[model samples]
Target: MSHKNKKISSTPKHTIIKALEKAGGRPKAVTEAADTGSDSEDNSSPENLLTPKDVIAIVTKTIQSELRSIVSELRSEISELGSRTDVVENQLDVVSKHQQTTDTEIADLRAEFSTFKDQLEDLENRNRRNNIWIKNVPESISAEALPDYLEGLFLQMLPDLSKESLNLDRAHRALRPKPNPDQPPRDIIIRFHFFKTKERIMASARNAQSISYSGSHLQLYQDLAQSTLKKRRDLINVTKVLRNHSIKYKWGFPFQLIVSKDGRSHSVRTPEQGLDLLRRLHLIQDSDPSTSASPSQQKTSAPTPSWQKM
Candidate 1:
């Protein structure tokens, strides 16, 4: 009962056999049967009966030999794999460097394309520099009489300008379907032979704030390229913020929003510049999308005048 309660050893079979040879009992009979097998002899001939220690030693040596062979094969495979990994790492580094060079070239091409696009837009705007857009003129005036009508309107705006000097190269309604009488009249685009005349009329009209012809109020705008118009349109939010702050703004040549403060001018060239200016002035709370701040934080921000300042 006491022997049954004792823990069995977890050591190798050789340790158990050694212990049994020292203890003379039923274990001796068991050992005798186990040691007599063909595979049990350690170096001794098969004709002689083998002892328990000899059998256990023979089995241990066989297992150790198998383990050594497996270990040798595994080591060889591991060494080969290490060499292959080094080559792969070198190849990956070359690929990484090539990717970096390709990325740099792509960036250079994109920059050149951007420069080309801006130059093209600038050329388009310069071509129409002497042109002006007159809106809300009544359709009652025929195309033949548009030239005379515009002359009269310009005289009304600038009473001092001589009639002979208002040399309008061309004046006509926009080339589109005429709006219904109830709808507002299509805009009239006029190209003056001289940019100076156009500039004077535009300046006078701006100072007057509004122009009226045949009792109907008219609006004046520059005949800008579609691209220039889009650039201005994209700044609508920025301009809206400036307007809300009571900041007066005006457009400059080559596309600039001019703002004056303390008799000094600051200009905003792009929408991002407008935003940064507003942020710098603390006109709006930080509304970075990366921030945890909610939607209510993004509503307000405020803009600009100068050829170069800011």
Candidate 2:
């Protein structure tokens, strides 16, 4: 036997006997039999005593139980977070779709508005086709006699025109009130019953070079919508520059001014285009004062073109 076996064997037999006696209601004979059995067992047997390996096994099982509980809680939290992330992603998808829809609607509205504006402008221009504007005529006649007076003036300006041949419709001054009492009277706007009659009068006026009544320099021009008139006025400077350079140019339909040079023709719609042509032709030098002025100021310094004299 070794020292460890001796130590285990040193446990008092009386202690074992007392433990058996403590078993509930055991007879004295049964307690003595248990003590005899304990004495007969080999004291060196390892199964009868607590050991380091058994303690380590118990601690390991306790730690494993706690670790399993922690892992389960972490898994549950991760599952909840994943669900919330899915909801956020879905919300983002809906917002993106709504934004796309709004952008599409805005584009559709803009396209419709642009088409409607073009149609309106076309209608307005068509209404003025058979009309003419006469400016700088003295307002000696009353409104009631204005139509007859205009017809008589037209007959005087046109050699072949007569009262029977001219088809008069209506004649009146501009609609707005005079800005100043001393300002010249508003131009007469005349609508003819026949488009041909309006064209014939305009041609005769061009041939006569200058028309005057009551010593006032009267002028005849085709009636145009205010928008078209503004665009043409904006190009007045360009026309003057073109005429000065001997560049053949004419006003085309719907507010286009076409210029022909070196066997090639270019259409201009804005003052910038005309300035570009002038720069290309070397007609406008970089140091010129008109080059730095606004388009309207440039026209003030340049002479009026023959075609636009009226």
Candidate 3:
């Protein structure tokens, strides 16, 4: 048929349009049918028209498109969540490291503070025990002169301490004893006191009878003097014996001695004796006296002295 004179196929248009209206008013089938079919053609046949399956397929496709869009959005949200989790993990790591560092710093500071506190305590202990505060003494004074001088000096200088008599002993009980076949001598030690003079004097006198002096005259001043020369010699001899026996003895710092029965019997070893004893003990070698080398002997018999080496 001539295109100008062709009749319009209103039947196919009507059928497709009716079918589209039943399927939620979709215009796709109507437009496609109108564009492809001629007015003279039998496009109205049911086989050529839109079917139930085609309508269902179109609906499914539309749903799939919407679902795909929703899936993309969900995927984006999941990716964002993952990123957020990573950030949280990083933050947690930073916090954990910071806590560890802070804890270490706290421990270091605590240790430093403990060290400072220990230093302070040591200073306080030293201040309490330091004997240098007693003043106006001669440099030339010997250890033997110290007890009497300091005792009188204390009475005169620090009278507020108490109006007490000072007692001095040249020989104390702690000294090493000398050994002699004729006389079994006792050890010598020196003692000094500020307040307990009578008790010390009595104790010294009582102990004097038991001790052997260098001479009988040395025993005459037993109450005033500490150990006699005989007793001191015996002490040195005993010290040698102890060395021979492979025993170690060390002189400790002079300490205050308080009698439990009476405070008046309290005494102290003069620092001079303490110093001398310490020096002497220091000179005592740890070597086996029976076998080991002696510095004195080595010095006398040096193959070559350091002076000769120079």
Which of 1 and 3 is ahead in lDDT? 1
Query: Model 1 over residues 262-296: C-alpha lDDT tens digits?
Result: 58677987777777777776666676533222343
Instruction: Give, for candidate 3, the lowest lDDT window spanning 10 residues.
Output: 301-310
lDDT of 3 by residue, 13-84 (tens): 464455555654444455555565555634445545566677667656656755685577677778888888
Candidate 2, residues 1-310, lDDT tens digits: the string is: 2222333332344443344234322333434455545656443334433344543454455456556755776677778777787787788777767766777787789789966765676678788888889898666666988877787787777758766767767788889875465788788888988787788888888778688876778889888777777877777777877777777887666567888888988887677777777788778976776645474534333232232111
- What is the model-wide C-alpha lDDT for candidate 1? 0.73
Q: Where in model 1 is the C-alpha error above 4 Å?
A: 1-47, 279-310
Which residue segments of model 2 deviate by more than 4 Å? Answer: 1-86, 177-181, 204-210, 233-244, 262-265, 268-310
Instruction: Please give the RMSD to the true structure for each candidate, in Å.
Output: 11.5, 18.7, 24.8
Say which prediction, candidate 1 or candidate 3, comes out ahead on TM-score.
1
**Candidate 3: deviation at residue 283, Å?**
41
Top-lDDT candidate index: 1
Residue 185, candidate 1: alpha-carbon lDDT: 91
Reference-based lDDT, residue 266, model 1: 78
In candidate 1, which residue pairs get closer than 3 Å at backbone N, Cα or C atoms, i.e. clash? 258-304, 258-305, 259-304, 259-305, 266-305
For model 3, the local distance difference test gives 0.44
